[model samples]
Target: MDITFLGTGAGRPVSGRNVTSSALRLPAARGTFWLFDCGEGTQHQLMKTSHKLSRLERIFITHLHGDHTFGLPGLLSSRAFSGGTTPVTVYGPKGIKQLIEMSLSLTQTNLEYELHIEEIEEEGIIFEDEQFTVTAAELEHRVPCFGYRIVEKPVSGKLNAIKLQGLGVKPGPVYGRLKQGLDAELPDGRMVYANEVKGPSIPGRVITILGDTSPCENTVLLGVGADLLVHEATFAADLPDKAVEFGHSTTIHAAEAAVRAGAKKLVITHFSSRYRQEDLEQLADEARVLFPETLAATDLLTVPIPRIVEPRE
Candidate 1:
């Protein structure tokens, strides 16, 4: 899985960045991209990337703020003409359904595909499939905002070709079973256990995306042990009071939350418009003092999620 920051600026568009929208590309795992927060001009941003609008399978809105969800109607409408025949599901808080329906209703928009809107009222497991499970939790925000935790399911290990060859297992359908960690019996009545020819299973990745919020216990709880924690840093660390007043987080708050949660990597976005690209980089540097693996996200920035491989001595 990978993340592409379409717009990293907070509140509104600025010189260097647009509003808040990010795309989680899972082409190999789920055969589609999941859009997290579709801010104004998000469809326009997608036009600039190589991603196809038709491949958007789900949209997870963090809040009802215009900066996070104003572009929903336009994008949903545009997808109908962009060869998107598959059904798309949107997951968000209580007002999300009303927002989408009202926008589409007011504009008299007709969609070719079915749009499923899941308005979450409480925090728990929101989405689960064979490949991944998505959980939601309440965050400390101005409104009833939420954060999403995506946990990918563990995958089978690679087949040991040398070990298989050593056991005289020819390349055939039996290899498929062995690769799936199943025992195979040879024609000579010799049974070969899958463990003999299969490496260790690959652990899945965990990604947490938090919306606009102040420092809270739920933030740390939801973000705990994530492979990547995408937290909001809307202000410098020195302006904690102002950040709290605005119901946003500072660089220090975000970094502290990541550290408390024991996240492996932290990528800070939702930057205030007052700061330029260089200033944002400095904020990232400040966060790095607390959480060394911190990154400041900019528009169109893609972060590939690293796999947690076991160390072999």
Candidate 2:
């Protein structure tokens, strides 16, 4: 699992950064990319990268802010022209359905695949599948914003080849069966055990994507133990008053939340247009003081979640 920042800038697009948008790519799971927050010119930002728009399985909006969601209509419509026949789902707060309908309705854009929209409120587990689960937590912002937590299903550990060989098992399809905890029926009618080869499965990665918001206790609760925390830091540590006034978070606030949540890594993003790339170091230093795993996010910066080896493959 990995997160790529498509647009890390706040309010407006900067030279080095775009706006507020991100894409989560799952390579091990056959290269699926879930887009979070379709900010203005997201397609244009994506064009700068090697990422394929057809890989977008779903899109989750943080709020209705233009910087957070102006690229929806174009991207969604262009997918059809690009031969994307797979279904896509969009999730957001109230008025989201209406917003999408209005955009498509006005443009009279016909989609090649099913387009589903869901408007959410309150905290709940919004999405789940065999591979991953996504939960949303209501965040305090100017609008009904939400933070998302993505937890991938546990992974299986490598099979003990030496152990299997010792048991007179040759490497073949049988190895897969053993690793899957299935008893292999030998040609001689004897059963080859799974414990004789497979060890254990590893835990999957956890990632938390914070929406625009002020520092709140729930942020820590929602972000706890996440392998990576992609959070908004609209201002530097010195501007706490302004952060609160705008219902946004400061760099120090993001770092403190990461520390409190015991997150493995903290990626500070959604920066205000007022600052320059040179000034990002000041904010990053403040976060590193609290959480050793700290980084100032930039456009297309991909944060990797280390692989782990679970019993349930």
Candidate 3:
């Protein structure tokens, strides 16, 4: 999986950065990507990247703030215009459906695909499938907001081809059965067990993406043990008071959350407009004081989440 930051500025768009938007591109087998927080000019940002609206499978809105939602309507409409026919599911806080529907209605924009809007009624598991599970929790924002924890299901281990060959097991349909953790009988009546030839299963990655907010318990709860934690650092370390007043987080707060959550890496975005491009490294440096794996998100930056290789017995 890879996360691409489309916009990284907070509050409003600036010359160097746009507002808050990011895309999570899944593996090729999925053939789709999920979007997080569609800030203004998000569609334009998509145009600049390799991501396609037609392949956008899901959208998760953090809040109803303009900086997070203004581009939603336009992007939805453009998706249809660009020949998107697959269904799209949107998950967000209450009033998200109304906002999208009302905007599309007023603009008379017709969608070519089915749009499924799920307004979060509670904080828990909001989405689950065979491959992934998504949990939502409220955050301390000025308005109602949420953070999402996406956990990919564990992947099965690969079959040991060399072991099979060494055992004189010729490659055939029986190999498929063994790969599924089933016992397979060879033509000579020899039994082959999957566990005997397969390596240990790999643990799936955990990713947590948070909305704009002050550091709170839910932040750490949602980000616990995350392989990648995407948190907003809207202010410098010295602006703790300002951060608390505005219900936003500072560099220190983000790093602290990462440390408490035991996150493997922290990617900070949604920077205040006052910070110039050159100053972003300094802000990230502040967070790195506590969490050395901290990285400041830049527009169109892509970060890949690698799979963990388990040791064999």
Candidate 4:
């Protein structure tokens, strides 16, 4: 899994940064991509990356703010012309369906694929499949907003081929059965347990992406144990009061949440346009004071999800 930052600016678009949009590319899901937010000019941003509009399986809108969702209508309309035939599902706040429908109706845009929109009313597990589960939590923002936690299911361990060969077990369907955690009967009528030759299961990865929010307990809870915490740092460290008043967070607040949540790494975006590139680097440096594994995201920046491995004895 990898994340590509499309637009990392806050409130509006600027020269270097666009607005709040990011793409989570899941290589395990046949290279399909899931969009986190669709800010203005997001379609153009997607054009810069290797991602295809047809490969966008789902979209998760953080809020109804223009900076977060203004690009929805255009992206939806453009997808039809870009060979997007697969059905797409959108999950967002209560008014998201109305927002999309109004835009499509006003523009008289017809889509080639079936569009499914789901409005989230409260916080819980909103989506779940065999490989992944997405949970939503209400976040502290000026309007109704949410933070999403995507948890990938654990994967099975690999079969020990060398061990099987040492045991004189010829490679055949018996290896397949053992890999499925079933015991295999040998030619000598001895039963070989699967656990004896199987390594430990690999832990699943967790990613938490929050909307424009103030530092709150819910943010901490949503980001707990996440491999990457994508929080908004719209202000510098010195402006705590301004951050709180505007219902946004400073770099310090983002670090605080990372510390409380025990997140492995923090990647902050949605920066206010007032911050220049050097200033954003300074903000990231300051955040490192509290949480060392923090990165300030810029447009087109990609981060691969780190795998978890058990400690050697």
* Best TM-score among the predictions, by candidate number: 3
Measured with C-alpha atoms, the lDDT of residue 145 in candidate 4 is 93
lDDT winner between 1 and 2, please give it: 1
Q: On residues 1-313, what C-alpha lDDT tens digit does candidate 4 reach at each position?
A: 8999999999999988999999998856476999999999999999999999999999999999999999999999999999999999999999999999999999899999999999998899999988889999998889999999999888888888899889888888898899888999998998889989888888899999999999889899999999999999999999999999989999999999999999999999999989987787898998999999999999999999977888745
Sorting all predicted structures by TM-score, with the top scorer first, yields 3, 4, 1, 2
Ranking by lDDT: 3, 4, 1, 2
Per-residue lDDT for 217-305 in model 3, tens only? Answer: 99999999999999999999999999999999999999999999999999999999989999999999999999999999999999999
Off by over 4 Å in 2: 170-176, 184-191, 308-313
What TM-score does each of the candidates earn? 0.95, 0.92, 0.97, 0.96
- Output candidate 2 Cα RMSD: 2.6
Off by over 4 Å in 3: 187-189
TM-score of 3: 0.97
How far is 1's C-alpha from truth in model 2 (Å)? Answer: 3.2
**What would the per-residue lDDT of candidate 2 be over residues 43-109, giving only the tens digit for each residue?**
9888877678887899999899889888999999998987788899999999888888999999999
Model 3 scores what on Cα lDDT?
0.95
lDDT of 3 at 49: 92
lDDT of 1 at 175: 94
lDDT of 4 at 290: 99
Better of 2 and 4 by TM-score: 4
